[model samples]
Target: MSRRSLLSRAIRSNGEPIKITIDKSGANTSAINDYNDDAGADIEIRQNKYLNNIIGQDHRPIKQLCKATLGFGRFRTARITIGDFESMRIIRKR
Candidate 1:
């Protein structure tokens, strides 16, 4: 198989979304960093990698990647990232 196909298969094989916390400037900070300290361009690179994986996986819903559960009862629920769910003040859909 081609390298692209192999890489795509490898990313999909994980079966887990790499949880990422993106900063206001669109940098993907580390999950362990509560302060969201600026880590420079590496953060953006990591975030892009995770995003690429997600897209490569065909946007499959992976529970591990879900940072928030929204809505309840007759509402359209969704799983969101930690940063968006908390920092952005998004209410739970469920």
Candidate 2:
């Protein structure tokens, strides 16, 4: 890709961090109240501080997409991450 394209992509990604949650339960229910009612599980918003910078992405008042979606470059070169992994994937391409 050209340098201009790269800059545009980076600019579009305002470095907003989206919020994510982990459901320990293996079952998937359509109703959120039912899920909460199933068991009184503590609801805590996960804001991992370790994921501040990976590809020069800021975390303070992170950029958010909708409710839980983040944007980053497509210069990956490593194994995929699991849902449990809260850290953002940083890939530096040559």
Candidate 3:
């Protein structure tokens, strides 16, 4: 494949569920650099902290879309169809 076609395919979104795994045990401690400095620390993954970070990152855009749908009639009146995975497929005829 050409470089341009390869890049275009890579950039396309294939709508997939993201999975995250966290180990509560300290067995898999990953080292993270505190700063650009050489100093580093090993930290275990905490479920609550991971969940909070995931929620913070993922929920904002969804909430904004919902808000826009409510605020704008054009967005609100979209023809919404529920697909196989319960994913909403919206089509705007306008």
Candidate 4:
């Protein structure tokens, strides 16, 4: 799918975002701008590599576990597996 449609679908599913931090991809920038114009919504876009590090850090452990398992065969199983992993992590932290 094209980047514009992909971005629009994401916003539709997740609801409109107030601000988005993205890499220096011109395609992504153009998509966001198009979405803003089409929807007549002002969504702030920040292009900063460092701003995305927190999201990357949070997903690191989950990615490592999935990599070791060679990935899940289905989306449902993956979602449940990751949900359980997160639940265990949260409980352990308490």
lDDT of each: 0.38, 0.34, 0.38, 0.89
Which structure is stronger by lDDT: 2 or 4?
4
How close is every model to the real structure, measured as TM-score?
0.18, 0.20, 0.24, 0.87
- Which pairs in model 3 have colliding backbones? none
Candidate 2 clashes between residue pairs 3 or more apart in a chain or in different chains: 15-63, 16-62, 16-63, 17-62, 17-63
**C-alpha lDDT (0 to 100) for residue 62 of candidate 4:** 71
Task: Please give the range of 10 consecutive residues that has the lowest summed lDDT in model 4.
Answer: 53-62
Please provide, for model 1 over 1-94, each residue's C-alpha lDDT reduced to its tens digit, 9 standing for 90 to 100. Answer: 6433443454459742344333233322323232224222122223355656656564233333452343333323442343444433334433
For residues 9-70, what per-residue lDDT tens digits would candidate 4 score against the true structure?
A: 89889999999999898999999999999999899999988887777787788788878889
Measured with C-alpha atoms, the lDDT of residue 31 in candidate 1 is: 33
In candidate 1, the residue pairs with backbone N, CA or C atoms under 3 Å apart (3 or more residues apart, or in different chains) clash, namely 70-93, 70-94, 71-92, 71-93, 71-94, 72-93, 72-94
Candidate number with the higher lDDT (1 or 2): 1
Higher-scoring candidate on TM-score, 2 or 3 = 3
Which ten-residue region of model 1 has the weakest summed lDDT?
36-45
How much is 35 displaced in model 1, in angstroms? 6.4
Measured with C-alpha atoms, the lDDT of residue 57 in candidate 4 is 85
Q: State model 1's lDDT.
A: 0.38
Q: Model 2, range 3-71, lDDT digits (tens) per residue?
A: 334433543596322332324322222233333344443333343434424433533323342124343
* Cα displacement (Å) at residue 93, model 2: 27
> Which residue runs does candidate 1 get wrong by more than 4 Å?
1-32, 35-45, 49-53, 60-73, 76-94
